[model samples]
Each structure stands twice: as C-alpha cells, then as structure tokens.
Target: MNEREILTNYVYKMVASLMQNGVEDVVISPGSRSTPLAYAFASTKNISIYRQVDERSAAYFALGIAKAKAKPVVLLCTSGTAAANYYPAIVEAKYARVPLIVITADRPHELREVGAPQAINQISLYGERVKWSAEFPIPDDAPMTLPYVERHIARGVSIATTAPFGPVHFNVPFREPLLIDFQEELPKQTFRNSLVGQIAPSQQAKELLTAVINETQRGFIIVGELALGTDLQQMWAFIRKLKWPVLVESLSNLRTNVPEDCGQYIVSTYDALLKSSIFKQQVAADTVIRFGAQPVSKFLTNFLTETLPTNYIVIDEDPMFRDSAAVSTHFIHTAIGEWISELSIENTVFSEEYLLKWRTSEELAAKHIQSYQEIEQDEGAVVRFLIENLPDNSDLFVSSSMPIRDIDTFLLPTKKDIQVFANRGANGIDGVMSTAIGFSEARKEREMYLLIGDLAFLHDVNALIATRYQPCKLNIIVFNNDGGGIFSYLAQSTVKEYYEDLFGTPTALSFADVAQMYEMEYMGIEDFKEVNKIMEPQKNPLRLIEIFTDRQQNVASHRKLWQRIQQELEQ
Candidate 1:
C-alpha cells in the first residue's frame, strides 16, 4: 500500500466509524486539501453529504442541523481561512450545547512555516471554542494506522454528544497524491460504539425538593431554552400538583405541545405582566424553580433580581456554571424526569390564590394583545400575525435582537405545536438565514419560516445562495425597517443626530432584487390579507416575504401595548 492507498484506507475507516457512532450527515465546503475525506463521504452509502460554497454559511448550516435533530453532525472544511470561517458557529455551538463534529483537512507538518500556500499552524486553531481538539497523525500504511483512526472518530463523536455537548475538532493532514481509485473495493469494518446519557437525582435530593414544593404557598416555575429530551409532561405534572404558574419562553419549545390541564396555568405573557415594577413586586414568588437558561425578557430578569425569592433552585443537567442573576439559593444537577416522578404524585391538586392572580393577569394582557386587528406598519404586530397564521407543527426560527424580543412578547404557551429556535448563545445577528436553511434541510417534511429583521437579513445574504439548492421549503419573512429596529427601543434612540448612522445602521437594499438574484418567490405584504394563506406552504422550496415597517412606530406600539395591559390589570 502506497500514499494514495494509506489516505484512502484512512478516510474509509473514519467514514465507517462515524456511521457506526450514529453520524448520518456531514456538511462539506469545496477545497483541494479536503478532497480525500469529501470524496469518501460522498462515496459512503449511509452518510448524507451537503455541499456549500462558503465556509461561514456551511458551519452555521451544520450547527442548525445538530441543534434541530439534537444529534451530532459533521462539519468538514479545508485548512487556512476556511477553517477560520467556522469560528462564529463553533462559539455558538459551545455555549448552546449543540453537538458538532468539526473536521478540517490540513497541510502536512512540513508545509508549516515554510511559506506554503493555504498552509498555517492548524493545531488547536479553534482554541476554547471547541470541547476537544486533536490533530490526526499523517496518513500511513502501517498495520496500526486503521485501528487508531477508528478510535479517534469514536472518541470525537462520544465527547461531542455527551453531557455539556459541544463541537470537537480533528485536523487531518495528508501528503500529496491524495487521489483514490474508485474502482478498487474498499474494506468493510465492523467497528461500532454507543453512548447513553441521563442525569438522575439522589432520593434525598428528591425528598428535599418535594418538601420545598409542598411548603411553599406561592411559587412559580421558570423555564427557558432547554436542550433536547426535556420531559415537558413531567414538568407539567409537577406544576399541576404544585398549583404554581409556569413562565415559558418561545425557545423553551413549550409555547406549543402543552397538555391542556397544565396549559391552563402556563403563563407566556409574563414579559408583559412583569414589565410593571408594581406588578413585579405584587406577584413575586416565595419559591422559584428555574430550568435551563434565563428567558429572553429583561423585565423578567428585573423581576427575578429585584424581587429575590427565599427558595430559588436552578436545575440543569449540564454542570457548567449558571445562575447569572446571582439570586439562586441552590443549584440542582438533574433532569426534569427523575425528580418530577417523586414530587408530582399528590392525589389532590392545591388551588393556590397565587395561581389565580397569574391566570387573571395573563388573560387581561392576552386580551389587550388580541385587540390589534391591523398589522400593516408595526413590526411587533408581525409576531401576532405569525402566532395566528403559522400552521400547527411548523418550525419557526426567530432571529436575535428585535425578532426574538417580539416573540418573547407575543408568543403564548398553548396546545399548538410550533417549535421556535434562535442563536441566543452569542446573540449575534450573522448567519440567521443559513442556520434556518440548515433547519429546513434537517426536517424536510415540516414547513420552515424565519422571522428576521432587515439588518440581520442582509448580514447573511450570502445564505440565500443556499435556497437555490436546498431541497426543503424556507419562507423568510423579513421585517424591513431599513435599520436596527431594536435600537429604537433603547435609550440611544433619543439621540437624534447619530442614532441613524451609529446604532441604527440602515442597509437600504431591495429584497425583491435579492429574490430575483436567488431565483425565489417574492411576496411583499402590507396587510394581513388572508394571512393564513401566506402561511401555507408553496410548491417552490424558497420564498421571500418582505414587510416594510417604521422603527419608531414599532417601539411606540410595544410601549403602548404594555401600558394598556398594565392599566387593564390594575383596573
């Protein structure tokens, strides 16, 4: 076996090991250095391969797949700047706890520091962004080479898919003559690996938590964005017995698919209810049990900080340091399943007066919100239209900044089945389109809709190129306010001189031309005329729906709604 044979066999072992470890998809960017692995991935029978022109978009695309499926997906790119392009998504994957198998094809050790083109020090390039990083030894025909490579792939997949899941890197260096003979038969290996994960609690811990729940007269369950496999039924069962309200965010994936018995006590309009400092103090809980990350609402943050609870327990399976509010009295390391079984077994459900207060507030606020029958101008109104129009079981990907803020404001936890997602880890605006495009690819049967702002839409406009090739349907509803709409809600909007130029950076590009360039169906909606019709899936895979809005009006509308709700609740 010579150099080509060594590279070919090594790539084959990697492909086989990855498949055995349950990796079904890999995203690849075109490059010469990565030809060997890319070829082998394409040739493999069980693996599905995706090709992207840009590395940045490709990485986010992989991140989206990993996030939606709650499984490890592979991202393969060439060395040099291509590997650098994956930095942003890797950072998001780390904090968001999404599993990604990052593989980069690098130049041989001899090529480094010798002024070789497309060659640089590729060792540990991603730094702390990845969970683990290792450089693959140069390909060899040694009898031991195949075994070590298989172990390497298995280790990478296991580490990535484990608790506190994140991206892991493996740099593969190859010499020249990387070509492989397609006619030759490849060796079939039987190597396989498996991993199972769950964080159960001690009996004593469960008893202590049960005592806390039973003793508290006033309490609330705070749930934010949780990873895959969170037992919502168990959570709701516990809440039903405790007779406490649950504040759920859109990213919690709890806005939909909720059991009606417990759904009656679920509070999704807390962002509005908590906005009033007076109400925040009035409805303060004596005990607060939080799960996953904090909800995307500053008012809710203020309520948690200003009205500190006596017994606040933060629960999560990941051991990473949380409790950003600094008010958590205890942190529990257990999933919702184990403890809920012990605590939610009460024969009679308590009818706490506190739950009545929450239900009343939620109803008043939601009624005021439903009064808005017109949405031709206001950006926030778009959220209401979406909540009302989007088909059941649809996937809604909200962009950071204004889009998610509005979603946190308008979305209600109910019996519908809408799943919401966002890049809230770094909270950056880049790659919004690409990530959703990847999601569309991941769940091809479900209809996908992206709620993005104008500024965020242009930031990753290159992702539109993917719409041409991706076989899934994507409906991008971009709120074209001509600039940063979120800044309009901040104090900086008071600054008239530099507001538009600095904080409110406007990009005046025609989205219709964008649709033309990408060859997508275009729809510019001014009003909610047959809004449900627009929400319906189309024959074309890609569609762009642009809504023109005034940033000032949008902010005013939000403030006005909050005030009206406050007045109604006060009355």
Candidate 2:
C-alpha cells in the first residue's frame, strides 16, 4: 500500500475505535494540519459534529457537552497555539472528572525544533492535566502502524471513561499529504473489542458503615457536586431513611427537584443560617458523611472545622484530595452511589430532634430570604428570582465568582425539576457563556438559562456566535454591576489606591450594543418591575436581559441579608 493509503487506514482506525467505545460527539476548531481527520470525522456516519471558531471557546464547549451527556466528547484542533488554547478546559475536565478526548494535529518529527512555523513540542503537552497523553507515530506503511493506532485509540477512550474519568490527549502528526485525494473507495472501518469492568465495594465498606451508624448519633451528609450519572433519587432515598440533614450545594443539582417526603432533611439555606455563631453551635453534628467534591459554601466548610465532628468521612471515586479544609477523619476511596446504597440497607435513622433543629433553621432562613426579596432589588434577589421562576425541565448554568456564590447563599430549595450547573472545577469565569451555550445545544429540547456577571459575559462575548450556528434557546441574564462586583466584598475593596483599577476592573460598555452586534434581542432591566416581563418566555432563540446594579449596594445588600437571617434564626 502507498503512504497515503496507510495513513488513511490509521486515521480510519482511530476514528472507528472511538465510535466502537461509544463516543458520539466531536467539537472541531478548523485548522490546516488536521485536514485529514477533520474530513474523516465530518463524513463519518452516526457521529455529530459541532464547529466553533475560537479554539478556547470550542474546548469549553466540548466540556459542557461532556458534562451534560455524562460521556466523553472529542475535541479536534490544529497544532501550535491552537492546541495550547485547550489548556483551561483540560484543567477543568481533570478536576471536574468530565470525560474529554482531545485530539490535536502536528507536523512530522523532522519539522521539530528548526524554527518551524506552527510547530511546538506536542509530546506530553498537557502534562498532569490529562489522565493520559501519547503521540501517535506519523502514518506510514509500517506493518505495526494500523494495529498500534487501533489499540492506542481504544486504550485512550477506556482511560477517559473509566473510574475517575477525565480528559485524555492524543497528538497525531501528519506528513505532506494531509488528505486522501485519490481514494478508490473508503476502507471498511475496523473495530477493536475491549471489555471494561468495575470493582465492587468489598465487605469492609459495609463493616465501616455499621461502625459509623452505631458510634455516631448526630449524623450529617454534605453533598457537593456529584459525578456524572449520580442518581439524585437514590441519594435522596438514603438521606431520607438515614434521617440526616443534607447540605446540598447548588452544583449538586440537588437543591431543586426535592421530593416532598425528603424536604425536611434537606438543608438548602445553610449558607444563610450558618453565618450566625448561635445557629452553628445549635446544629453541630457528631459524625459527618461528606460526598462528592468540596462544598461551595465557605461557611459550611468553616462550620465543619469548628464543630470537629468525631467521624468526618469523605467518599470519592477519584483519588484527588477533595478535603481542602483538612477536616476529614477518614477518606473512603469508592463510588459514592455504591457506598450510599450499601449503607441504606442497614435502615439506620439518626436523631429526629437534631434533624428538627436543621429543619427549623432552614425554614426560618428561607422565609427571611423570601421576605428580603419582597423588599429588596439586589443581586441576591435576582438569584432567588431566576431560580424560583425557571421553566420546568430546564437547566440553569450559573457563572462562577459572585453568581454562583449568590446562588449558594440565597437560592431557596424547591421541588422543581430545574437542573443547576457551573464550572466549579477550576472555578474561573472565562468560559461561562460558551459552556452554557454548549450545554443548551447538547440538550437541545430543553430551555437553558445562564445567570452570569458582566465581566464573565464580556469575557466570552465571542461565544454568542454559537447561538446562530447551533440554534438553541438561551435566556442570558447578565447582572451588569459595571465591574467585578464580587471584589466589593473582598479585602481589596478597602484598598483605596488600586481597588477600582485592579480588582474592580469596571468596564462601562453597554450590553445592549453587544446584543445588537450578535442580532440577539436585548432588554435592559432598570428595576424589579422589569424582571417579571423579562422572565416571560422569550420569542427569540437568543435573548439577553441586562440587570444593572451598583457594586457598593450589592455588597451592602448581601451583608444586610445575612444579618436579617441571623436575627430570624435568633427569634
């Protein structure tokens, strides 16, 4: 066979292997060196292709798809700085445990280190951020090339989907003929059959569970962001039977869709009540069973440390040290679902009086937050309003920094089927808009809403192009505080000299102009009266509603809201 034929076979095998292993979606950023693979993927049957112009936005878009589908999404980009642009999403996938198959094209070995254009050391490029990384040999007529490509692709997919799933990288270098110009007919695709298995929890897991139930009277379950495919129903069942108060984080997607039966044990407003020293002292636990990643609430983590629960245990499938507060007494390395399921069979319930204390505090704090909404028109009120009014079966993707922090602080628990998502792995504000748009595209049938700050929205303004290409209905609510409003609550707000220039970083541009540029419908919200009309179902596919606020008032309102909750808890 000629070199072109051999290379075609290698590329075909790699794509075929990914299909066999169940990868269905590919996000491609156009580039020259990746022509062969790009055309191959585009023409392939059964795989969906999503094209994004910006490489950085494309990577995060892939991350959102992976997050929503709970499966691996492949990302294709050209060589050089194009591949480098994928670093932010790579770090997020690693920490967030989202499965991503990142493929980048490169020049042949001879082109390396000779001042070659668009050539950089592609070997081990995304070091430590990816679960595995390997460079595929330039396709040739070598006997082992076909089989090696087949096996390597299968292994890469396996690692990405296995326990502690994460991003994996494969750099494919192509020689001169980056296209199969003359194909007699496409080679019949071949597949590699690999059986993946899981290790069940041993009897020791059960024994440890018995000890936890027998020794501890006041038990608490802190549910942070769960891994993909984590059944909230099953978790709720366990928590209901265990009769323990569960502090569910916003990203856990647990604060909503709460069953009426389990509502009493679910403490959704802990961030409000936990601010008061009296409330924290009143509701301390003897044993804490934490699950998923760290909780978003700094107040909850500090409460965990101050209480110093006797048996503070954390169960995670990944080996990553999630206990940043340094309060875990035991680390159980196992699947959270499996462990919780086994523990449920014991049918042990903790103190109802302890649960009642949490219930009372949750009730009081929620009422205070609701009342604050009636009288106030601040960022906190906006968080509550958006969450409380989200369309049924829709998803809410909140930006990091002030947006997510506000959701954690004031958004009350509900029985609605609204799913909440955020990029909390690295927790940067760079790709919030793109991530939400990608998520909406992935779940095309559902309406999606993005609650983002001005800076985050401006950071990814280019992502608005995705709405035109993918055509998903996204209700973008921009809290245009004119600057980094979260900084107002930070220490830098007191730094009179450099606070406005450095930390606040105010950008006075009108989002209405931005909306017009994208041809998206724009509405400027001047007061609470306008929010109701904006919340009505939008006619256009992409709608931007800008809610303007004062940075100083935002900080003061949050402080007053916390103080109000404290007084209510005391009452």
Candidate 3:
C-alpha cells in the first residue's frame, strides 16, 4: 500500500474504534489538513457528523453535545488558530468534567519553525487543561502504524470518560498530500472495553462518617451544580433515609426533578431566604454535607462561610478543592454514587424541628415571591415563569451573568423532571447560543429552552445560522435589557461617570433583522401576557422571544425583592 493508502487505513480503524467506544457525534470545522478525519467520520455509518464553520463556535457546540449525552464527542479542526479556538471549550470541559475528544490536524515535523502557512507550535497547546495529551505520529506504510493509531483512539476515549472526566488532546501531525480522497476498509480487530475506576471509603473512613452523622442533630445537605444526568436518585433516596433538610442548586436538577413529597425537605428558595438575617439565624445547620461543584448562589455560599458549621464535609470525585470558604472539616474524595450507596443510616434521625424550620422558611419565602410575581413582570418574574411553565422532560440551558443568578434565586421547587444545563465552569458569556443549539440537537426528544442575556446572545450571534440546518425544538428567550444588566447591581454602577461606557457597554442592535435573515420565528414581547404565546409548545423548530426591560429598573427590582424578603422573614 502507498503512504496515502496506509494513512487512510489507519484513519478508518481509529474512527471505527471511536464509534465502538461510545463516541457517536463528531463536529468538524472544514479544512484541508483535517480532510482525512472529516471524510473518515463522514463515511462512518454509526457516527453522526455535524459541519460547523466557525472553529470557536464548533468547539462549544461539541461541548454541549458531550454535556447532554454524558459521553465524549469528537472535534476536529485545521492547524493554527483553528485549534486555538478549541481552547475556551477545553477549559470549560476540564472544569465541568464533561468528556470531549479534541483532534487538531497539524503540519509535519519538518515544517516546525519554518513559518509555514497555517502552522504553529501545536504540541501541548492545551497545556494542563486536558486530562491527557499526545502527538499522534504521521501515518506510515510500516506495519505498526495501524495498531498504534487504533490503540491511541481507544485509550483517549477511556481517559476522557473515566472519573474526573474531561477533554483529551490528540495533536495529529499529517505530512503533505493530506487532502487525498482515499477510502479503505477498516480491519476487523478486537477492542478492549473502557475501564472506569471506583473507590469507596475504607472501613475506618466509613466509621468516622457514621459517627459524624449520628452526632449531628441539625444538619443539611447541599447539592450543587452537577454533571449532566449524573444520577442523584440513589443519593436522593439516601438523603430521604437520613431525613435531613436539602438545598438543591438550580443547576443541580434535583430542585426540579424531585417528587412533590421531596419538596417538604428541599430548600429551593434559600437563595432568597439567606438574604434575610432572621431566616438565616433560624435555620442554621450544625452540620453541612455538600456534593457536586460549588453552588451558584452567592447568598448560600456566604451563609455557609459565616455560619462555620461544626462539621462541614465535602464529597467530591475530583481532587480539586471546590470549597472557597475553607471551612471544610473533611474532604472525602470518592465517587458520589458509591459513597451514597454505602452510607449506613444507623439508628440516627435528624430533628424534625430543624427540618421544619427550613420548610417553613421556604414556604414563607415562596409566598413573598408569589406576591411579587402577581404585581410585577420584571426579569426575575420572567425567570420564575419560565421555570414554572417548562414542559416535563425539557432541557433548559441558562446563560451566565444575570440569567443563571436569577434562576438560582427565583426558581421554585417543582416535580418537573427537566434537565438544566449551564456553562458555569468558566462563567463567560461567550458561546451561549451555539452551546444551547448543540444541546438541543443531542436531546431531540425534549423541548429545549434557553434563557440568555442580550449581550450573550449577540456575542455568539453567528451560532444562529446553525439553526437553519440542525433545527430542533429550541425556544430562545433573550432578555434585551440594552446593556449588561448584571453590572447595574455591581459596585461599579455607583461610579456613574464611567459605568455606562466601561461596564454597561450597551449594544442597541435589534435581533429582529437577524431573525428575519435567519428565517426564524421572532416575537417582540413587551407585555408579560405575550410571553405565554411564545413559550407554548410550537411545531416551529426555532423561535426567538425578545423581552425588553430597563437595566436600571432591573437592579432596582432585584433590590426591592430582597428587601421584601427580609421584611417578610423578619415578620
């Protein structure tokens, strides 16, 4: 076989191994150097190929797919900045523990330091952000070429899906004549199944945990932002057995997915209640056990930090310390599922009065929120309405800044079995639209809803073009507050001299024209009543719902709500 034929065979086997090991979706940004991979994935019947033009958007698009599917999705791009565009998504995947396979096609070794076109130092480009990195050798006619590439593919997938799952970098260097239109049959070879490592606490550790549980009278469990579809059912059942009050973060999905009876134990409105000194004092926990990543609500974090519980234990699978408070008495590094399954609920029960305090506080806060909703239709109200009205088994993608904070503060506990997603790892406003679209495409069965800020929508506006081809049940509700509404509440807002230009950075662009250009169903909603029509289930695959509000008033409304909560809780 010629060198090109050898390369083609190696590529086919690598692609086949990826498919064999749970990589179903591949996102390709068209380029010459990556032609072999593009064509190989396209021809593979089991792999679904998505073509994206912008490399940056494509990377986040793949991140969304991986997040929704809870598996590794592949991304391929040409050399130079095309691979660089994958950096942001790689950082997100690393912190969020989402599995992604990033393949960057590079120039041959001889081209190094030669100032070749579309060529830069691609080795270790992603640095420590990736779980593993390797330079896949150029394809050769040697006998070992096929086995090497095949084994590399299998190992990369295994590393990505393992606990502490994240993106893996495979910088593939290809020699000239890379665009050859060669097709070859994949050899039938036995493949090893990916191995996952699991650890449970030692007998000594379990005994310590049992002692801690038995001694605590007033304790709480905080479920923070979790990996997509990380099964919390067993953990929830364990919490139920312990009968402790639970605080479910908005992105945790537990707040939305728990059964109605579970509501009596869930403190979904603690974000609002914690702002009240009276309520915070009344419901303080002696012990606090946390799972998953840090909670998104600043109030909850501050409350835990100030309370300084006697026993603060964190259960995390990753090695990184998620606690910013530095108040943790113990950090248990073990798989959450196994830890919860093995936790022995001895003859110990939490105080009913302690649990009742949290339930009453949540109920009181809910009443205040409901009253505010009846009177106003601001951004917070819009957030509440979206959460309350989301269809069962839906996917809700919230953008960072104000949108995610609003959902965390205002979203009430419900029995809805919806999956909530957000890119809170890096917490940047970039790539909101593309990420949501990719998520929608991955979950075709569920209706997808996106709550995004206008700036976030405009930052990744080009992603809208994708809907024209990969349309799904996507309803984008853009809060067009004219500027960075979150800035209005920040300390910088007090410095009015430079706030408008530097912090606010308002963009007066209208999405109506863009909507028309994209042939999307657009609705300009001024009255709160009109949102009902936009949110209702529609056969149309893509729709944009724009709601305009004043940034100044948004901040004022938020402050007023907090003040109201404080007053009600004090009463």
Candidate 4:
C-alpha cells in the first residue's frame, strides 16, 4: 500500500479500536495538523464527536464527558499550541482520576526542536500529569506499518482505561500527505482489554484485623469520598451484625437505605462533634475502619490525626494513601465491597455504651442542622436551601473552594443514593465549570447540578461554547458573590491592600451577558425564596441560575452558623 493508504488505514483502525473499547465520546478542536485524525473520528457512527473551535474549552468539555460517564473520553487537537491548551484539563484529570485520552497530531521528528513552526517538545508536555505518554513515528519504508499503529492505538486506549486511570497522550507525527480522501478500504483492528492489578492484604493487615476482632470492644467505620459504589450493603450488614457504629461521609454512598436515625449509623461528617470538648470525651473508638479515598475536609484530617485510634485499617483500591497525616496502621489493597463480602463474621454484640454515645452525638448534629438559619443572602442559607430542595436523584458537583467545604460542613444530602463528585485531587478551581459540564454530558438522563462560586465560573466560561455530545440537563447554581469568597473568609483577608487586590479581585462581569453569549437560559434571582421556584424544573441541555449574595455577609453567616452549633452543643 502507498503512504497515504497506510496512514488512512491506520486512522480508521485507531478509531475502530477506540469505539470497540467503549469510547463513545470524542471532542475535536479545529486545526490543520489533526485533520486526518479528526476526519477519521468524525466518520465513526458509533462514536459521538463534539466540535469545539477553542482548544482549551474543547479539552475541558472532553474532561467533563469522561468524568460524568466514568469512562474514557477522547480529545483530538492539532499540533502546536492547540495541543498545549489541554494542560488544565490534563491536570484536573490527573488529580481527579478521570480517564481522558488525548490524541494530538504533530510534525515529524525531523521538523522538531530546531525552531520549526508549530513544533515544540510535544513529548511529555503534560509532565507527571498524564498516566502515560508516547509519540508515534511516521513510517517511511515499513511494508506493514498499518497493523503496527493499529495495535499500539488499541494498547494505548487500554492503558488509559486501567485503574488509577488518568489522562494519556498520543502524538501522531504526520508528514506533508496529511490531506487524504476517505475512500480506502480500512483494515480491521483488534481491541484488547488490559488486565487490572490486584494486591492481597499484607500480613500486617491480617494481624491488625485479627487483633481488632479479638480485643476491640467498640469499632467504627468511616467511609470517605471516592469510596462508594462498592457492595456497601454487605459491609453495612457485617458492621451492623457486630453492632458497630458506622459514620458515612456525605460523598460515601454507603448510607443508602440506612436511616440517619439508626442508632448505629451517623450520617454527617462529625461536624457538630468537632465543636465541643464533649466530642473528644464521648467519641472514642477502640478500632476505626476507614475505606476509600481521602475525605474533603481539613477538619476531618486534623481530627483523624489527633484522635488516632488504637487500630486503623485503611481499605483502598489504590494502595497509595493520599492523606499524609493518617498513614494506615494496616493497609488493605482489596476492594472494600469485596472484603466485606468475603468476611464471615458472626453476630457479635457490642457494648451498648458506645452505640448510645454515637446516637446522642447524632441527635446533637440533627439539632444543629435543624436550628441552622433559613435567612437568604448568606452562605449558610444558600447551603440550607440546597440541602432541602436539591432535586431527587440529582448528581451534585461542587466547586473546590468554599462551596464544597460549606457543603461538607452544613449540607447533608437527605437522599442517600445521590452521587456527589468534586475535583479534590488537585483541588484547583480552574476547570470546575467545565468539569461539571462534562459530568452533566456523561449523565444525560439524570439531572446534574453544580454549586459554584463566581470566580470558578469565570475561570472556565469558554466551556459554555457549543458542545457536540447530547448536552446534559445541567442546572448550574452559581453563587455570584463577586470574588473569591473563600479567601476573604480565611485569615489571609486580614491583609488589607494585598487581600483586596491580590486575593479578592472581584470582576464585575454579568452572568446575564455570559448566558446570552452561550445562548443558554438564564435566571438571576436576588431572593433566596425564588431559588427553589427557578430550580424546580430543570431544562434539558444547559441552564444557568445566578444567586447573588454579599461576600462579607456570607462569611459572617458561616461564622454565626458555627457559633449557633457550638451553643446548642454546650446546652
């Protein structure tokens, strides 16, 4: 076959491999260098291709799709700076553990690094942000280059989808014959599934668990974010059979069907307990069972570190503990769900005193949430409204800064099955809006909601541009408090001039203008009562609802809410 024929065949095979490997979404940014790959991807009827002219937005849109789908999503961009624009989303994916497959068309090896136009060090451009990176060389004299490229593409997709999944980069170096007709009979490419790695619980893990099973009179299991969707029912059954206390984080979907009022189960993240000295005295665990990824709160991290349990077993699919403070006394590499299913523990009665104490704590937390003020124009009220009126079965995606922290502290989802996702890995607010948009796209059937601040929304406004996939029914509730409200609430705000200019640079851009620009439906509500009225029925595709508030008042409201909680605890 001629060079053009071989290249065309290779493109066709790669697209076919991606489709076969369950890649249903593709985002393409217009550029010259990537025409062949773009054309090939567009031709695949089974795969959905979204067209985005802005490379930065396109990359984030793809990131959103992957995050929502919990599957690999492909991003195609031309060589040069177009490829470089994907860095933010790549970093987000790396930290968030979202699977994004980035395919960039590039100039050949000969044209690189010599001040060549549109040629930079494309290899490893993402640094440690990507899981794997490879540059595919154009074959000049190979008799059977089509099959080789096809095989590599299949492997690359597999590697990208494997556990501890993140972004993957493939730089295709194409020469002058980039523009080719699509009339060749493409060769078939075989898809191979990569094997996932597994590690058995260490000897220390076995010994630790055995000791806990023997001596510990009271046991508690605390499940954090990224730790749900496992067979939590079995874990629930196992713990309940032992009459052990189980504290489920809002993000940990394990609390499904387990009533918050259940004596042995407490729902909130021990937020109320953190306020009182009685918390330290009453809530002491002989053994603490921790499963899943790290929790989202600094307070929780501090509590876990300071009140170290006699025995702590960290059960995680990923062996690495992201938490520096709470290094696991025993690390279990197996899935929490799998371990719960395998363990055959008899119905052992726990001391009623431990369960009674936890139930009292639960009552205290419930009272705190009930007494939380309902006044509008404050952060506490905003959160209270969200927790009360969040649509049933709605997937909630929160921004990194204050929004998530407030949600963690104040808003506890009444519906236990609601799926909550946040980009806490790196915890940067750069791609939050785009990531939420991507998440909505992946979950098209369900209602997806994003509670973001103005700064985070402004950071990725380009993401609102046209998307190719079926746009998700997204209800974006933006807390337009002008600037970085979180920073003002922190100690850094005490610095007068520096805090005003450097930290709180409130841009006066109107959300109405942005909504008009994107042609999305917009609603600006100043009254808190109107929030539920507007958010009642969500529209398909996209809708932006801006909730206006004063930054100073929001911060004060948060403080007052905490003070109220402390008062209730003391009483």
Error of 2 at 425 (Å): 0.4
Model 3 alpha-carbon miss at residue 407, Å: 1.0
- Give per-model TM-scores: 0.96, 0.96, 0.96, 0.91
Which lDDT tens digits does candidate 4 get at residues 1-571?
Answer: 6877666766777777777667899988888888888888776676787877778878878887887667889999888999989998898788667788899889988999988898888988888888888877684447556556666666777777665668899888888777655743444555455454544565566665655765777767777765323555666665655556666665665543454434356556476567566665566666777766667756656667777877787776665655577545776666554455444454355567887777776666766665565443576676766766666667888898988887777655353446677877678888787777777767767768888999999887877765433444677888888888988777898878678688888897669987777667788988766756655564445788898888898878777766766676667
Our model 2 lands, by Cα RMSD against the true structure, at: 1.8
lDDT of 2: 0.84
Candidate 2 runs further than 4 Å off: 181-191, 344-349
Q: Give the range of the ten consecutive residues with the poorest summed lDDT in model 2.
A: 181-190
Flag clash pairs in model 1.
none
Error of 3 at 112 (Å): 1.8
lDDT of each: 0.82, 0.84, 0.83, 0.72
User: What's the residue-level lDDT of 505 in candidate 2?
Assistant: 90
Instruction: Give the per-residue lDDT of model 3 (tens digit) for 324-439.
Output: 87889988876666566566777355688888888887888888776766767788888777777787988889999999999888777777777778998889999888899899
Best by lDDT: 2
What range of 10 consecutive residues in model 1 has the weakest lDDT sum? 342-351
CA shift of 387, model 1, Å: 1.2
Positional deviation of residue 61's Cα in model 2 after best superposition, in angstroms: 0.6
Per-residue lDDT of candidate 2, residues 109-184 (tens digit): 9998899999999899999999999999888777788778878888898999887889999999998878764333
